[model samples]
Target: MSSFPDYYKILNIPKNASTDDVKQAYRKESLKTHPDRLANASPQEKKTATEKFQAVADAYYVLSDSQRRREYDALYSTRSSSDKSDDPNASSTFFNTFANMFASAAGGPTGTTGDQRGQRPDADHVFGDVFEDLLRPEVESRVPWWAWLGAACGAGIGFIVANIPGVLVGAYAGNRLGAIRDAKGKSVAAVFSDLGGNQKAEILRALAMKVLGSAL
Candidate 1:
């Protein structure tokens, strides 16, 4: 499971965003993703909108409070530099139940029951910097942020399920999906607008993975 939701990313603000910025982002995002705005859309679209609404609400709830936001930001920094051992949930030696609980809390799929847990022990370390390698500024000036975000998420989820093979496959799938969105010339905000609950769940997971790569 990931450490915490990437509130900064969810709100589309920088880590150094001001309180006013948080408030404005919340208002804008809430209005945009509010389920009421999608009443006439398909059931799936409505459900996705609802999930995004809740996720946004969750991000705002944590970020609006100065004390909580301070603590969350500390945890965010710690998780980036700490090794897998510092995080029992991210550790490869944890129990399936604990892993599942953290995974669920981290917005991972609920369909991971009966799946393998902690098989390789070192899978997370493998390809740890894949996102960093691909996301360098020289790669492309216009590649949206979510492209790397989705890729990091793919790798994080892969660590939880199939280990090494899962990481490779997940990264590829995430990259492919992001590529499709890129080809369509989607902006970061636009891509996020169409994402569902499962996709949003990966936000923090991707952030942690990304920060780790940068720290290394």
Candidate 2:
């Protein structure tokens, strides 16, 4: 019998992981397995990393969606219970099943052959965007108004206490402190977590539209 792929295991996450956990896991796994990270490695190493990257993306795609996760959990339970350990066609079987599941969910035709289904456009699409985004990292932080205030207050206090040198030192220290407190940067995973719901959906949708338009 064919076995379903354990997405939770693929992502190194628990089955009971929340959506945020799933997003964090994906970011972690994808970063580790990303193709660019293996650019200096051997061809075989690069190939292995690519496969792992693709698998991580696939797992994330399913587990990140509430409806898809529920459906996958049900099918996963059913298949895992009846699957034989020695099944040689497990990989192909699971690919077909997974493709069909997404197709059905998207209201797309599911009659495509295993080869066609296994050529996952959505996974490739996701991989492209993820790599591109990773290449151009973003930091969600800004210098708050209090930084200037802190600097001014520090300068005033220092000038009264000492002189020009004290004012300079005080202003520098105060500004640095305020900046450190207010301009706390988020990690890539945290950025991904923050980009949940509409922001993420809009990004993917915009990419899909662009791809479609380009193809046409």
Candidate 3:
């Protein structure tokens, strides 16, 4: 009898893991097993890593959603019970039932045929969504105003002491504005337009310090 994959086992997470826990686990596992990270490894190693990465992404896709998770948990529990039963046909029946249910849930063909039984459209869509979410910037809590002020002051002091060209400093500051927005979770342009001249200068200063500090 065909067996269903244990998603929690794939993700190395507990069955009762929270949504945030699943997200964190997915991020950690994806990074560790990413194909790009295995480029320097042997072909076999890269192949194994790619499979593992896909499995982790699939597990996260299922466990991250409330409805899908509940359905998976229920299916898993029933399958477990069926596996322990002494009836010869119990396991086969369980697999067939699950395949039909999974196919329906995934919006694919619902038949006992191997191709239909293994279809997973929802999994593919969820995988894409997970990757997209990972690529996008999330809004984070803002840093304190005083912290920005201090960074600006420190950057200005560094520039003066190093005798850097004003044009270069301005260019560096401009480029770092995007980083500041990502870090602060706000529009850099909006901040400048809404605040007074001094505040804008401080923001630019803080951004410059951030870029310079990373370089140093």
Candidate 4:
């Protein structure tokens, strides 16, 4: 009737659906259409998912509130009847009332000059920065040439002679002696030692290759 969105249709719920039904539908739809779920999807797919997810959230926001829902229904009902007679004044009045109600609920506009409109921050830029940061590759600390030399000497002596105990003892001694500082002033050896499972293994492999190359 009104040019306003049909919140019920957006949420895929019947007009007579209870609050619980609305909540359930919102949860189901939100999870299925959430942008985060399409992280690895194509750009167009992610954009579409984000738009649908926002619509679902907006629909839920209005429908979940009794007062807002009542106001929305009343405004639309008036607009629906007025539309039968093609009244432009009624349509304009409905939009004005909706805007005023929304502004009031949002604590009114903050600017002085009696202007009802407020400047909104660019949401795309904010979210884009967040996603970029999340997707950015981790920068590994540069391994100092001196540290590599020390690790190389340790590895050659430890492994070249095929001494398993020497290798273990050398590693322990190197970990204790090699106290290179990272950008945060933390010990690099200690940081590497604290790494878990595959991460530690990968770093160890690189260190081994460096040492083996130096030995040859």
Highest TM-score: which candidate?
2
TM-score against truth, every candidate? 0.37, 0.49, 0.46, 0.40
Q: Indicate the residue-level lDDT of 189 in model 4.
A: 54
Candidate order by decreasing lDDT: 2, 3, 1, 4
lDDT of 3 by residue, 1-216 (tens): 555667776677888899988976765565555555543589888666556655665567567767667877886786673344322133234433443455545444421224554433243243334443432334443554433543465467557756556435544443345444655556656645866664454334333434442110
Q: Which residue pairs show collisions in model 4?
A: none
lDDT of 4 by residue, 1-216 (tens): 345556677678887888878766765565555566554689988777666665565556556667667876775565443343212232333333454566556443221124453222122332222222221224433754434554556666877666886676565444333424322245555555765664454344323433442110
Of candidates 2 and 1, the better by TM-score = 2
What is the TM-score of candidate 3? Answer: 0.46
lDDT of each: 0.52, 0.59, 0.53, 0.50
User: Candidate 1: where are CA atoms >4 Å away?
Assistant: 81-216
Which candidate, 2 or 3, has the higher TM-score?
Answer: 2
Judged by lDDT against the true structure, how good is candidate 3? 0.53
Please give the range of 10 consecutive residues that has the lowest summed lDDT in model 2. Answer: 109-118
Q: Highest lDDT, which number?
A: 2
RMSD to truth, every model: 19.5, 15.7, 14.0, 18.3
